[model samples]
Target: MQLQKKSKKISAIAQNKNLSIQFSLDGFSFCITDLTTNDVNLFSEYIFEKTIASPELLLEKIMYIFANDKDLQQDFKSVSAIHQNNLATIVPNDFFDRNNLVPYLKYSVKTLATDFITYDNLSSINANTVYIPYVNINNYLFQNFGEFEYMHHASVLIDKLITKIKNSSIKTGFFVNVAPNLMDIIIIENDKLSMYNSFSYSCKEDFIYYILFTAEQLQMNPEEFQLTFLGKIESDSDLYKITYNYIRNINFIESTTCFFNEDDDFSNHSNYILLS
Candidate 1:
């Protein structure tokens, strides 16, 4: 990555910290790691009171974060950004064609001529993630960091989960990453990705409905298939309670208390994309 320093006065360490930021419709979170120590020196998130309406407004929110968050306004040896949105689709590697990006996402998500479509080749899952990223946000990062790397959040979440279960004793199960209004469901069978899909819900009914509906389509019995929960959910939450009511073998997957050198308390399941 090329370094783009915003200030000459900033120390060389400004060029040392590797920065990673994940953006969502609801908010964005970032982490900076030291080059020499490999320690996460800073980690924080800015969640909007409600989900923003447009990419333009989302860019404004990111601008506010960069303006206010001093640690983020520095140079970096490397910068990686993750775009989290529902506008993505997974195409099996065998059927994936670079020129078919627009066609791949058009049916699942609304697109426009101005939309810049890109993809991540998820070799692990033998799939390619085709989706649209926030061009304005990428431009801002280019202006600040000169060159950086990015991918759809699904690429991170799905690829990681697929690689993970393939190594474990687990064969067939349901892994769900539950966010405030969204969830990622990965159904694995015989150590292969049977299905992976994300859904948005306003109520518990909507949430379980999508999960059970997907399982029924796959002929997965809820009473038997194991369900492991991750992301911003607690056992006490209504989301957890409702899921447990329907699924018999349900539990939260255990993760370390912290990944940073400092005790910046974060759950294992919370930032599985960024922290892990």
Candidate 2:
């Protein structure tokens, strides 16, 4: 279902704005930015009390937000949606084929003949991010707003972290992006992506198990490597508290360094992808 609203008549000057949305079955959040001044016009997240069981419901929730959130019902120079799900994996440039998409994801994730497959190029690492975009969600957004760019949230998360790794003195470390129901663990070594994976957790025990397990697989020492936290997390949150107990030399990505933060209420390290 689509939201009912009159077409917003944006003046020619309105093109200097952009909308960024990141969503999954767990939650939905969006932000609007004034490109001319590099300022954020608005940012809001619609929390889901429990995980939505189906795509139809998720789409309905998004449509409801678009109908009520006055900030979302505006014109923009561009709109980009980030699909946050574990149905994504990375492929080295040498093995990537434009003619075939299913083979890349077949082993990593179960795919059907009907699943719509797409990829995002990771030029920074000479690879491509392959995954399933929300075809239904894309159709809905396209139906209302016309053509807009979209990609897996992992694509944005990995690429942005790569830039940070290259510029930092530290090379090898773990970067964990925590959201409502899932977390992505990205391992970097010598300024290159060593590993990238995402996990779903329902409790603190499950959360720390994934991180500790990943570290064990890589033989990474808890006391040596510095870990950086990002996305919807705080120093006192259960996730951070548990992580700090297991990992040493932990820190957050400063908000001042974040390009998309203009609101005092927004956490410096939260929503790293949407604000990017």
Alpha carbon lDDT of each predicted model = 0.80, 0.81
lDDT measured at residue 189 in model 1 versus the true structure, 0 to 100? 81
Write candidate 2's Cα lDDT for 1-276 as tens digits.
333221222233345888888888978887777788766666777667778897788888888887787777777888889999989999999999967989988887989899989999999888999999888899988987898999899899888888877887876868889887889999988878899998888999999999899999999988887888888788888888998899988998755335443545567578788765
Q: After superposition, how far is residue 38 of candidate 1 from its true place, in Å?
A: 3.8
Best by lDDT: 2
How many clashing residue pairs appear in each of the predictions shown? 0, 0
Clashing pairs in 2: none
Q: What overall lDDT, based on C-alpha atoms, would model 1 receive against the true structure?
A: 0.80
